[model samples]
Target: KVQESARVSGILHDIGKLVLLEFPDFFKKAKLNKQGRITQDSEYAVLGTSHSEIGGYLLGMWGLPNEIVEAITFHHRPSIQISTKPDLLTVLHTANGLANMCLMEMESDFGTYLDMKYLDAIGVSGYLDEWLSITHQVLDNTDNDQVQT
Candidate 1:
């Protein structure tokens, strides 16, 4: 059940990226490099709105539950105080971290940087290393499959 909620949270987390459509130059500038690399410098030089915050705003506009909105809003900054402790938010936070790590390894232009306070708030610090390892394994498996195909 929590996983399902988290799935919803993940789906809504990046909804703010849609707002970037308003800034074509910024969007183009933020494109991943040919090698699929993104850096803090590139982001600052490109689109101004980070996807994490945008997603939260989108969720709020859609009238989602406050807990859901908080999850979406604070997934990147989980240290922020929220009215409720939603398990879904924690799940989204962990999943986002894992996904960011995977995307970084894949050389995706999109970068993931979250506050460490989020991990402590979620009570899942020990799982980070494990999740990172699993993310690599998953990437390797996908790469192997692609090579075989």
Candidate 2:
């Protein structure tokens, strides 16, 4: 039950990124250079809304569970007062951090910062290796299956 909410939270975590597509200049400015680097300014600054908040707003509009909505909205700042325990938000926080780290290495234009305090608050300090391993395994599984398609 809780895990399901967490999964949903993860899926909806980036819902705000969709809005960035609406502004070509902002979206293009958010892109990384050929070498995959960005300056202090982010594309979101131009769009005027962060992905977390945008995702939360959309989820709320969709009539998702309050917990799910909170998890999606506050995953970036789990310390904020929400109705549920830190579990679902923690999962999302960690997943988002790991995903951001991966994208950073890939030179993705994603400009969000992964808050270390969120990881600590979620008690996920030691699980990074396992999380990354699982992520790679899932990616490999999908890649392998792609050949079949």
Candidate 3:
């Protein structure tokens, strides 16, 4: 169950971007000054909606589970999500940040590559090292045979 949740969360995390690109008219007036990088403020100001919100709404309409929808909705800044207990959304947010830190180099609108505040809020800040260690172990074990395409 945990593995499936992680898989679904990973697959749907950036689905909002697809929603935005598929419906350009919705963001037709959105400015390109930010190089199409839509942070919370920029997206709300220019497009009148963020991709996260759109994706969440679409997923809900499509009858996806609430946990998955919520995770995708607040994946960017889990601190903004309501709820004290750690949930799938929290995991997604942490994983998303870690993945971003590993993969992206471009200067982002939001300050840090990861949201430590969110991690701290969920009381998992102390476990980050363990997570990273596992991440490194996984990467070290991967082989070219893992790539299908």
Q: lDDT for every model?
A: 0.62, 0.63, 0.69
lDDT of 3: 0.69
TM-score of each: 0.65, 0.68, 0.73
Worst 10 residues of 3 by lDDT: 102-111
Give the clashing pairs for model 3. Answer: none
lDDT of 1 by residue, 21-115 (tens): 67677755675765464443465566554666677777788888777888887676676655234376677776676666565554322224445
lDDT, residue 100, model 1: 64
Tens digits of per-residue lDDT for model 3, 16-100: 7886777666566665543344456667886777878888888989998888998888887677877677888878876766544
Model 1 C-alpha lDDT versus the unseen true structure: 0.62
Write down the TM-score for model 3.
Answer: 0.73
Name the candidate, 1 or 3, with the larger lDDT value: 3
The number of residue pairs in model 3 that clash at the backbone is 0
Cα distance off (Å), candidate 3, residue 29? 6.6
